[model samples]
Structure formats: C-alpha cells, structure tokens
Target: MTTSPLAASTVTADMVWIPGGTYLMGADDQYPEEAPAHPVTVPGFWIDRHPVTNRDFDDFVRATGYRTLAERTPERGAPGAAAALHVPGSAVFVAPDPSAGAHLDDLSRWWRYVPGADWRHPGGPGSSAAAIPDHPVVHLAWADVAAFAMLTGKHVPTEAEWEFAARGGLDGATYAWGEEFTADGVHLANTWQGEFPVENTAADGFVGTSPVGVFPPNGHGLYDMIGNVWEWTADWYAGHEPPRGCCAVRDPRGGHQAGSRDAAHPEDPVPRKVLKGGSHLCAPNYCRRYRPAARMPHAVDTSTSNLGFRCVVRPGHPAEGDRAATG
Candidate 1:
C-alpha cells in the first residue's frame, strides 16, 4: 500500500489526497451499464476538492485565452452533423411544462442546442456564468477538459480513479456517503427533488448546479462527488468487463477507443467516454444516477448544461511540482 499524504497534511487546500486502495468498481443493483460489480484498485492521487467552478474555469480562460469546444462553430460538412450545427452553441436543458405531454423517451423535449450557449453563457443568450460563478462550470466538451487539464498540468481522472475517489473509502456502498440517498432526512447532494425535465422542486435549494461545498463533504473531504454535475472521466465508455480471476485489476480503464463508438449510430464513429456522478438533472422519476457507481456514456464532441469536470494530480507526475508551485 502506498503511504497516504492525507495523514501527513501534504494535501493542498483546493485538493484532497485519496489514498490508494482496492474497492468494488461498479454496482450490480442499479443501471445495466454499471453492472457485474467487480474489484479494482487505484493508486493514491490528489483530486480537486470539488468540481471546477466557473470562476476557476474563467481564470483558465483568461490566462490561456482558450476557447471551449462549444464556442467554436461546427464545420459545415462534418459527418452526422445536425442541420443547424453551423452555429457556435451547446446543449441546454429547458424544462417543458408538465401539461405539454412531453414523453421521457424523447429527450429532445427538454434538451435543445442553444446558440451562444457556452461556458460563458450557460443558458443561451441572456444567461451568464457570472450569475453562478461558484457553481461548477458547464457546457464543456472533452476537448475543453483536455485543454484545461493541459494548462493546469493536471489529468482528467480515469473511470477507476474517479469511482475510487467518489467512493471515499466506502468500498461497496451504493451512494457516495452511504446506502440511503437521503441519510437522516437530510439532502446530502444537489439533485432533482421532483420529476425531471418537467418539474424540479428545488428541494435541495437548487434547480440547477449548486455552489460547490454548499453540501457536506464525503468521507475523503471531497465535496460534490455524488451530484451537482456529471464529471468527465478519462476512460472510454464500455461495459464493466473486469479481468477474470481478478487480483484486483489495478487502475482499470474502460473500453478502448475503437470499441467506444456509439452503436446506435454506426455511421457516426464518434467515440463516447464515461461520465460519472449524475448531475443535478437526475431525479427519481427520470434518472436515479446520483450514486457513486452510476455511469453515463457521452459523445466526445458534445457538451451539455449538466456536464463538468474535475482534475487529478498523481504522485511522481512531471507536472506535480508545477501544480504545487502554482496552486
């Protein structure tokens, strides 16, 4: 076992040292994709205490003058491109009225590609990330995360690493904190209280992303590990095919890039990546994915309102010194 810096107080204020350990990577009870609950081990690494916020991302943008994927207009003749994909925009969740007879099957009823919907203007035209600077930054594609990670000398956590940290030393528990979604009648994370895509009660005091650290931290002092927003993982989207006769598959990445392509549309070979920690849009009636083991496959080119990311810095990484000196 690697010695944990967490005990030595070497952890930075903005990050937490997740001790290396073995844990069950997925859950068998919930969601078909996250099945065959298997054992995996990950090395200890430093993870952001919370999801990267708008203020944090804004600083990155200001420093590097980087433009997120959403800000760039799509090429005209791209394969499997939407008819209206010429504009620079990102997907935004606009809840329709319950009386409108919006079927849950058709996600288009709620999700619409809004022009000018980037990290700066999360809700399309009039809205601004400035209004919720403390909230986790949204409307980021995989490339955006890549750019941010590169600039900061950090890495996007792999699926195994992410799941391990999210578990917060809780080996096989269902949720991040515990088995109960709401422990002791207290809302632990920012999740949809009522029906999703139609009505949100804001019971957790938020309809969208809540300010990071507003909710209680998990066992590892990591906040928003379960909800607030879905976080990007480095691993590709694939089934949980753990190595047979496991010796605790160390740091198992998901499916390979070629196999991660969306099977639904074979014509478009755009690969999907794993997204963990279901977002604020998750609800009981819709997506009950606010659990630590829950996983979602997202296209690399797509950016949504409820998707964001955090980064990690493993020990012995070349950028480790740089991160410490800068942070």
Candidate 2:
C-alpha cells in the first residue's frame, strides 16, 4: 500500500502507512460545495486501516471508564441547549413508511432524537453495540472522539489528510478505488440501494452500518474510506479554499472557529466540523457523496447513528513513537 518513496518506521499491523504527497483536494463536477478543486500536499502518516469499531471503542471505554457525550445528560441552562438536549440521547435513523406520504425534504421524517440512544444502545433502549462488535461505533460527538484519540495517543486526521488518504494515491479519481462505483456489478462499499429515507433495497447486504473491512480496501489498504459511515475530521466546516498562485498548499488545515458557525440560522449559531465519507445512507438519488472528494458539515456537539471516525498517527508525534515501541 506504500505509494511514495518516503519510508515509515512506525507502521503497525492495524494501521497503514500512507505515503503522503500532493493531490486534487476537491471535485469540480459533482456538488457545488465540492467544486473549485485544488491541489494540496500532506506529510506521510499512519492511519487506522478501518474506522474505529465497537470492540475497539469498548476497550477504550472499559480501560478509561469513559462515558461518551451522548451518554450524559446536557445541562438545561447550557448555551444553545434545547429541551431535547436535557435528555441523554443521540440522533437515530428511523425510516418512514412510504405509505404515510413521507416528505423527502423533511429529514425529521427519518431522523429522530431518541432518548437513551448512545453508542452502547444504538437503537435507543434495548439495542446493544456488543451484538455488532465489528461495526463502526457511532453516536460519538467531537468531544468524545477527541477524548478517545487523546487516550490512544493518536489524533484525528484533518480534512486534507483524510482526503489524501481516502484517495489512496489515486489522485483526482472520483471514487476511492477508481472512477467506477462498482466493479463487475458487485458492490465495493456499503451504501443505500434504493430511494433514500423510505426504501433501502440493501443491495450491498446492509440496511445500516456494516462490519468494518467487509469491503475491499482502497489503494492504501484503507477500508470503508468511502462508505459505511461518515467520518469526522479535525477541521472546521468552511468550504474549500482555493490554492494561491501556482504552488500546492502544504499540510493545509481548515478555517477558523468563528467562520465555522452554521449560517443557515442566524438566530442559532452552532459551529460545525467537516465530516468526510458518505455513510450507508448515501444513495445516487439522495446523498451521492460516496466519493473521495465528498464531504459534509455537522455540528460539533451532535452525534448520529451514521457518523463515526478513525484515528491517525503523524510522524514524529507521540502516537508515532508509541506505535514504534509497541510494534
């Protein structure tokens, strides 16, 4: 999976050494937000081959006695806290019946803020993550993800770093594996098969999150880089910034915190972070973001059943030294 000439001394069995280089960061043909494709360079780093699974997260929780944000009740008087936030819960996807004349535009028809719905209880009260130990752990907010990374001595990948790794050395390609969405009519990633929100044909053999590494890995040996679940990156949610002059930006990050505020509702200013990789909920008819250049914005304090993340260990970082010693 090594692509560049640079060598990595801290490669591990569970992590892939992404030989970093420059690549087109965004897409100009797909969604408008993904337009203005620009060139960006990243340093070589080690990234988890797959998104953090339930078993991996469970180990961290058991060792550190960590309770995720979704598991804690939010303060009623906290700024921007709504009545719904007073309860311990996370957003869960519940498909609406087409027979009920479900509105396609109203996401509330499909997403519900369920009480008691956290990573441990993905389906609210009775569901358990232990039953699907191999699946990517969802319902994690930014704070929870940061805490996990800190405990593991790893760091969340920035938007540039994530996109570079997702490309898997195939710069400017539409999908992670190549331009084709599928190979010989076989699904390569877990994605929606039918009309979104109401119908899911499950052609990929999954109605929700699938077990990690079930699909073929990308050129970098990174699994689930394009689907299964959207992954959080360490960047604020401002649109792509075009490169200046003719030089490709090196190790570019994201916008400032003040600029990351969601402008959709001026009355409620909540900051958002960039989320990469489309989830199993992605479909051609709806969110066709199951590509290397695809990205979305999500509030920092919010968590969803379809949102998850992976960790990265940059060269010379403490995590890199830890991996080198452990490996």
Candidate 3:
C-alpha cells in the first residue's frame, strides 16, 4: 500500500500498521444495530496503538489553539435547544447511590451534565488531567476529533475499517483477543467489574479510564481496542441492511447524513455518529458492548467523559496530497 504523506511526519511510534483484510463486519445475534452480519473488506492502514491520550491532545491544542465542543457554550436559537444545554459541559458518569438501588433504564441516574466537564477537567472544574496525563483523553465530540485529524493530516477510521482492525484477523470472534472475556479469571480489557454505576470491583485494576497500554495488546499489536473508552468513528449512525445471501461488500461506508438522526430524539435534529469499542462503563449486567462488533450512536455535538478518538492514516488519500503540498 502507498503510504500517506502524514505517515512519515505525524504517525507516532505508538501507531501500528494494520494489514487489512476481509471480515464479518457485524454480529448476527447481537444488538439490532450490529445485526445482519455482513462481510466487508478494507485496505491496509495505520491506526493509533491506543486511544489518543491527554498528553497527545494537549500537544495538539497547544499548537493549534483549538477548543473542544464540550468547552463551548451552545447557541440559544438552535433548533431543539434545551435550557439545560445552554451551558458548556460534557456528560460525566456519576455513580448512583448504592442505597437507592441503581436504575438500569434511567441513564440520568448515573449520567450528569456537569458545568465544566471538558476533556481537561473530566470531572468538572476542579478535576484536571495533571495526574492522568497518560490516560485516554475524553469528552471529545465528533467535530473535535475531526479538527484534530485535519491538524495531524490523518482521518477518523470508518466503521468498516475500525472493525476490521479491531478484529485483529480473528474472524467472528466474540472479543478482540478471543471468545472468552477473561482467561484464567483474569480480566482482559478495562470493563466494569461489578454491578453497573453503583458498584465497581475494578477487577481490571481500574475504576475509570486507565493509562493506555496497561493491558495486553490484541493480535494486531493494538491496545484498548475493546474497552477503556468509546472511540469515535467516521461513520454516521444507521442500521445496517441485511446483505444479499452470502455476498461480501467492498469498503462499505456508513449511512448518509439525512438518515443518521436519532429516532428517539428526532426533534433535536443533531446527527449522530457511530461510537465503537464500548467503554469502562460497560458491564455484563448493563452494557455488554465491549466486543469488537458492538456499536453505539453518539450525537455529533454531545461529548461525554467516556468518549474519545484515535486517528488513522489511509494509503494514497487526497488529504495526504494536500498536506504534502502545504509542507
């Protein structure tokens, strides 16, 4: 594969070359969004070895003076603008009161829109990334990830590309590493250990986002592909159509913008993008979406404490050509 121009300049030592191939892109029996398991083939590309870290994002912000969506206050006149969304903040995972009995259906029981919960201040104003520089940078919306990608001459991976690399050549495996969630009673990924929201045993040695690369790498030598954080993808969130009997698709992109709106919040009109790999909040009793095939729809303008992204370098892209010209 021809190398991207940014590969030489911006591709850090933590980036790993994913030799791509065909794979079953979705799960047949899982969530409806990931159903109709289809075959998809993707070209080889380089992906970050782990989710973008606080240090990496800090460097980007320092160089470009960019502001994340969570750091910006929402305009009042926008369609479906709620009073609660007027202030600048991101959704933070707040543990529910153990005595009150956790409500699984009510997400508000555990999620709160803190006033100053951006990437730098993950838990609001007082919190800082100073102590967790190596942790994955969270609270990034789709536009924030896009800005970073443009600045670095990289692009966000499409759903197909992300899943292909995440599989690590293990076709139809339940997890990135294998069928088992753990081996010999050892946790593989940084998923929730106990009951959701109320209790966390931290069996994986972390209650929240752990430092990237603390866990074992997948077969492709990629870190945190399944958990630790939910990663942004280029694909717009749309349900997959069932494939024609036993046929594979070539480099399938996600749905169009018009169809990417969330059905539950149709009045809002903010388009949603696909988020993959689950997060530290995922648990067996709650969100069992830590698998490679799992996917979630996140609004483009809505950032959360568990959301972040990594960049990908595709071979012979026009963006790379543009970067080369400017350089």
Candidate 4:
C-alpha cells in the first residue's frame, strides 16, 4: 500500500487519508505494556488533521529560513556544554503542585528543565508568540521533529503510522471513541482531571495547551489525537513482554534512550527517540495515556512545552511537490 506518488495529490490541508487497515494492537486489560491485542498491518498513510500549528510552524519559519532547536545558538557540531547552550532552548511543563497542590508525582514534579522554552517561549521567560498564537507549537525535540520532517517533505508518522491514524478505523474499542473514560464525569480527552500531584479539574476547557482544533475528531478526522499533546512517532522505542500482561510492547521505543519507560512501563524516564501523544498528565486518577495505545518516550534532544507535530501526505502529488501538506 505504499503507492503514494503523493496519492492522486490534493490532500495536505488539515491532513487526512489514513485508509490503512488491521487493528486491535494492544491493551490487555489496560497497560500491562498495553497487553496482547496484536494484529497490526498499516500501509495507507497521510495524517495530521491538526496538531502542529503556530501557524504551521510559522509557515516553516516563513518558508525554509528553518531553525528551531529552540532557535539554535551552538553552531558547528553542537551537542551541549556551551555554558549549557548559552541561550536558545526548550522543555517546560512546570506545575508540580500549584494551587492544585498534589498531582501524584507530577511527572517528577511538573517536568521542568527549561532553558529558553522553545516553540516560541512556552513559559520560559515571558512566554510569547503574540500571546499563544492559537497555541500548539510546543518545544519539539526528536531533533526538532526530525528537523520538521526533513524540511517539510514530511516523514514523522510511524508507530504503525501512528496507530493507524489513531484507530480512527476503530477495532478493539477503548476510548479514541469506544471504551469509556467518561460517562458522567465528562472528558473525552484532555486528561488529568483531578489530583495527580495536585488538582487540575480543567474538565476539558484545558489548563494548558488546547486549541489546535478543539475536540470530537477521530474516525480519521484527527484533531487532538487522543488528548492534547504527545505525538512524535517515527518509532525508536521497544519494550515487549507480551502474551497479555506485564505492560510495554509494540512501537514502544520508549527505552532506547528517549523518554525512557519500561520499568514495566511507567516509572517514566528511560525512553528516547520521541513518541508522545494525547497524555499531558493524563489522568483517570493517574495517567490514562489518552488512547490509541497511548505512548511516551521523548528526548531526542529533549524539547517539550508538551511537545507537538503533524504532517503527512504521500500518495501522489508531484507536479512540483514542495508543500505536500498544508493549507
């Protein structure tokens, strides 16, 4: 199914197509490394109904002026220790228990590590972008989303093409539009509804990041994917222990070096190569992972204001192909 010459062209905006097949990938009773539900497939591609904005990476830095490693500053073979990267930087999730006070462990207490906070100042100093220019541009890192999917030719969807476009085709049923994270409590996504390391009953309006397209958009339409932030697949995390128990399996490259996980899947801190999606402190009492086989393992240079990315379209569109998927 890899026939995309750009696939008859015309698809790019908001991104869609998905079309792949096979489902029921994991979740053997909810996170035993996402348990033996196997049977994946994948093939047809194209995804990004939302989740990569700041006006589309600010029009890819206004067309190829491209620079985001938090905005660079090291120069010539850089990798750390220029006074800890002089300036230009990222990673910001601070809230280890504000007035909400007590959000469980709060991912090592609200994931701080701020340098300059990329994605255009996401809470690093004053946090600007004309005041959140519609938000959803986060710090980014897997080498700055593989350098924005190789300068926007596109190439960041593979964890079986991001759970076959986040199970928009539906199969094993469980959230993403099935299961039931909320019947009366209300919250289809945008997690951590209550006391994690504190309290964040944002209820869905959102306590942080949340504007890319609002909600109610699966079945391939896309939107939030599962919650709010946590998408960066390209696979590089592995943690198998299947047969239906003992969590951490398939496309879970969260243990090679990135976001490190696999201490049976949750002590968070050992994953690498990036792969976050719908789980910004996800909570059903404590981390639901949002859905579509929820994953986490970011750190390919480490960047996150909750991380963000989206771009796909490869079936056939090469009259002069350049902006393969954008409005």
**CA lDDT of 81 in candidate 4?**
14
Stretches of candidate 4 above 4 Å error? Answer: 1-43, 46-69, 73-86, 98-113, 116-138, 141-147, 150-152, 155-164, 171-194, 197-229, 232-277, 285-305, 310-313, 319-327
What ranges in model 3 sit over 4 Å off?
A: 1-10, 77-85, 320-327
Shift of residue 96 alpha carbon in model 4, Å: 2.8
Clashes of 2: 0
Q: Note the Cα lDDT for every prediction shown.
A: 0.83, 0.84, 0.83, 0.64
What TM-scores do the predictions have?
0.91, 0.91, 0.92, 0.34
- Model 1, 50-161: lDDT tens digits are 9999998888777667888788877775532345658888889998879986478988889888888999999999999999999999999887886677667677888898
Per-residue lDDT of model 4, residues 1-327, tens digit only: 123233243456667787756666666777665655666655576777887778767776765566777777545334431354466766676665466566464465777656666776787877776576766788766666655665555666666567667768777777777777676766666766767646777877788877776667777778888777788776656653343454323333223344344444465453454364565567767777787876655545666677676766556533232221111
lDDT of 3 by residue, 91-204 (tens): 898898899886788988988878778999998899998779999999987778877787677888888888988888899998999999999998889999888879999988
Please give the distance, in angstroms, between residue 320's alpha carbon in candidate 4 and its true position after superposition: 7.0
Residue-level lDDT of model 2, residues 1-327, one tens digit each, is: 112112232344699988878899999999888978998989998999999999988987877788988888877754423475588888999999878763667887898888899999988999999999999999999888876776676788888999999998889999998889999989999999988877899988999999999999999889999899999988887888898899999997787667786656555566778899999999888899999898887888899999999988887775421211111
RMSD of 3: 4.4
* lDDT agreement of model 2 with the native: 0.84
Candidate 2 segments whose C-alpha is farther than 4 A from its true place: 1-12, 77-85, 319-327
Q: Worst 10-residue stretch by lDDT in candidate 2?
A: 1-10
